[model samples]
Target: MTAHPDRTAEGVWDLTVATPIGRIKAVVEFRRRDGALTGVASGAGEDVPLRDIAVDGTLVTWKQSVTKPLRLNLAFAVDVRGDTLEGTSRAGRLPASKVTGTRRTTPARTAE
Candidate 1:
């Protein structure tokens, strides 16, 4: 069975994440392949696949490692609400950074 679009984090999202150096803007795309939740985050001229993606109801969490401006192992936990998501990301002992994202919407195609 297919999950409802609003209830699932299976779409493209624009994310703004706060970091010690500065705020990093990224785009994350979530997908379900072979009944498994998977995702990828692209930012800072790098595209990295997310690991350990877990979803429960409207809560989604994943781990990602980014190497571009710098290298850091990140863990993300977020709550999806309709078209928006709010969450936090932590890197080791560093303070958690606020993560906010909006689902990207595509215009509906009309038959000619």
Candidate 2:
């Protein structure tokens, strides 16, 4: 697993989720401050806040509240290859589903 130098100590991650609801894509922005992770989920008219984001190596876990007063417990074990992130996402108490996502690549910067 490779880490991106451009990846913020905390930042947003765009993910694609495969569900019975079809393929839903969202941007989950995370901030690591004082060993706590916090962020928001943006997709399907849902901008839900994420709580208790935790990262152990390449594995990430968090909780997101749905609009219907329900919450999803998500777990992702990501392997970074270049600009792509391959992983699995499991929602709530269901079994994990295969997921693959790419990070939006930005142009390399030149030293000023």
Candidate 3:
């Protein structure tokens, strides 16, 4: 079988959100496993786990749970181009907020 490109390359994502309070920034680190994406978000002094990552061509979608007494679910979509990623995020709740971000290169390995 032909070898697929390694998806486990770690990368950094810089996100901007337009909230009622104001615009907020979030930096997320993502890693891939067998073509599935997984990562963590660094926001509000916490590292939150990411899930439900899907990649279709240049489009990517994933869910991030923001649980700090109050549970908030955030869904994101990004477009991958070359070594960069650009996308938007929205809340699972009604009247969703819009978020945008960029992904940059990080460290990578051959295997986990």
Q: Model 1: per-residue lDDT, tens digit, 14-72?
A: 99998788899999988778877788998888889999988887889999998878789
Q: What Cα-based lDDT does every candidate model obtain?
A: 0.87, 0.62, 0.68
How do the residues 6-112 of candidate 3 rate in per-residue lDDT, one tens digit apiece? 34224776777777767777787777667566788877767798888776666777788886434788888876665556666777655656766665644423566
| All candidates in order of TM-score, best leading | 1, 3, 2
The RMSD of every model to the true structure, in order and in angstroms, is 4.2, 5.7, 5.2
Position 91, candidate 3: lDDT = 74
Q: How does candidate 1 score on lDDT?
A: 0.87
Model 1: worst 10 consecutive residues (lDDT sum): 1-10
Clash number for candidate 3 = 0
Could you give candidate 2's per-residue lDDT for residues 1-112 as a string of tens digits?
4453323324556688777667777776665556566677777677888766656555555666665323565656555554456777767678777666665444222479
Q: Residue 26 CA error for candidate 1 (Å)?
A: 0.4
Better of 2 and 3 by lDDT: 3
Off by over 4 Å in 2: 1-9, 68-77, 80-82, 105-112
TM-score of each: 0.87, 0.64, 0.69
